[model samples]
Target: MPIELKMPALSPTMEEGTLAKWLVKEGDSVSSGDLLAEIETDKATMEFEAVDEGVITKLLVAEGTDGVKVGTVIAVIAGEDDDSASAPKTAPAAPKAEVAAPPPPAAAPVASTPAPAPATASGDERIKASPLARRIAAERAVDLSQISGSGPNGRIVKQDVEAAIGGASAAPAAPPAASAPQAAPAPKPAPVAAIETDIPHEVVKLSNMRKTIARRLTESKQQVPHIYLTVDVRLDALLKLRSELNASLESRGVKLSVNDMLVKALALSLIQVPKCNVSFAGDTMLQYSRADISVAVSVPTGLITPIVKGADSKTLSVISTEISELAGRAKEGKLQPHEYQGGTASISNMGMMGIKQFEAVINPPQGMILAIGAGEKRPYIVDDALAIATVMSATGSFDHRAIDGADGAELMKVFKELVEKPLGLVA
Candidate 1:
């Protein structure tokens, strides 16, 4: 019996996918777990593997085709030596021969294969259509190559077409003759070029992921009574600790970043201020006993937040290891839906991207999101004297319906102390 090769669900929310390319042709023998095609979903480009070993007998969809729903049969594989199960045999010699040959000479041009003609429309029957013309035609839904030219050598020149469409030509002036040179005289005042005003034009279709982002963000902003609290932390000690940790862990293939430390800090702070870690549920608020911190990781397709569950209970080293694996899997689109969704609190770090400070939108169901910015060297009062220090800014967005401004500020105080002191986090 022939086996159907259906489009596998790359991610939980992925419904339809685009078949980017096929690795094997029809009739090629394939093994189970072999890469068969590359599929593009709303999240990432993933390699779809063949689940059954057999000869590829049919391909229902071509490459670059989109809107193929998940579980749709895309291809078929026939069992070995089963003539009845195999695809109907068809002669492929003629198409192969045509593909193998070099194009014919221009003297005897074939009508089947169209060649580009000159662009100038002289008195001849030909029309001159430039490559730009052909591109414009494809974009504007015009058939330039198909149109019969009224100009020289079947050329569809710009002016002739404009005239045919009842439009005037803003023809360019010809350059001066190269054979005759003019003498240099007094310089004339050069006219300033008119600046083109930027027209506010925006009508592109929204991508599936973008549409989801829009809907979720709108709901979050409208329903959640948002209040923001900002705090500045000294990062000199934290930076030293990270360097020492990374130096020791380098040989073990574990890289500990400041963001990793922040994850731990947030988790520890959440444990102290349990109220800040709660999420609002309709008329009631639910406070989680365990701290699940969702760290936002940017993938090629879009942003995804993967959770590190029970982060408050786990040591910093464990958080580092788990986050590394989670980020790696997230980039490859190997993360399960549950692995990314359903966190008690979240963190969005733009510090690495050179962002000084920025606010973040709340993820649905989560009452708070911490926005972190880059550290910069500045003068600060030390022992009643000004001294150089490294400081970083952080903003906490809390749901007013669940958390108050004073309560959020208190939580920030604990988080700030944990990050600035650095040694206390381990202690």
Candidate 2:
């Protein structure tokens, strides 16, 4: 008997993926734990491993095929005792899976009369249209029954509804009667001509990672109620402390970055003001026990947050080294799901980019994100006297549903104190 190899979900949130490449061809011998194929999910490209030893019998899905649904059979394998020669060499018949499909012909039955009425099938029977197509039809005032379906089993789809609307708009209108006093027909507006220029441009298709980023960010803004709080903190002490510590640790190959110190300070503050370290669970609030910090790293694909687990417990050198390695792997798209998935809080430092200050969107399941800005010399009041000092602005974006404004302010207060004092971070 031939064993079917289905497309595996590379991540928990992965519903579909591209069958980027196949490692083995038909009749190739494979063993358990063998590399089977490269599956490209929305987040990363992961290798698929074989669990059972077998010979390649058939490739059900081809390489470069995108939007292959999870659980869809991608290949077939013959057991060691089974004869590979007897198994099928070609791919089995399957539905075409594409990231974007062309609009099919209208499937709804077309009514001869042009009156605005709901489209229906013959003898007032209901039309067979997809839910999306039905919604589009309602929006466009299209009659689904009059349009022909181009989908499977004569089902109406989005394209079919759109095509029907286009056809209706393009149809010739009836002429006015000669006996009636006719008003002058309004002049048709001229179509705008395309702007001609020598500027070179190219259309690049959106990658899965880019698509996921857009979707998740959109959801974050729309679903989460964000409250932003900004505070300016003097960073001279923290910078001086970092410089002195780096000098002492240079022999041990440990150099601490200001961002690393900030991560520790944030973790400690979250522990001090535990209310800020919570996730909004709709009917409940989930207060986290440990401060796992998700550090946002901008990769070529998009923004990814690789977490530094238990930041409060880890030493400054350890946090710095871990972040360096995690960031490098994240940029290369080599991070595992667990390495980037969950965290109690997040830190997005744009200070390196010279950004002064900006509000950040809350990554869901996490209550707040600390946005760090550039440290620059600015006028400040110290001991009732104004003086120039090195200062940085930190903004905390909190989920108002889970964390109170007072608690968020307290967290910011503690974070500022830790950075300004400098010793609390090391102690």
Best by TM-score: 2
What is the number of residue pairs that collide in model 2? 12
What is the Å distance of residue 120 in model 2 from its true position?
A: 58
Per-model TM-score, in order, reads 0.63, 0.74
Which ranges of candidate 1 are over 4 A from the true structure? 79-215, 243-255, 281-286, 321-339, 381-387
Off by over 4 Å in 2: 89-91, 94-200
CA shift of 291, model 2, Å: 0.6
What does candidate 2's lDDT look like per residue over 227-318, in tens digits? Answer: 99999999999999999999999999988999999999999999999999887765656677788899999988788998888898889999
The TM-score obtained by model 2 is 0.74
lDDT value, residue 218 of candidate 2:
70
Full-model lDDT for every candidate: 0.68, 0.76
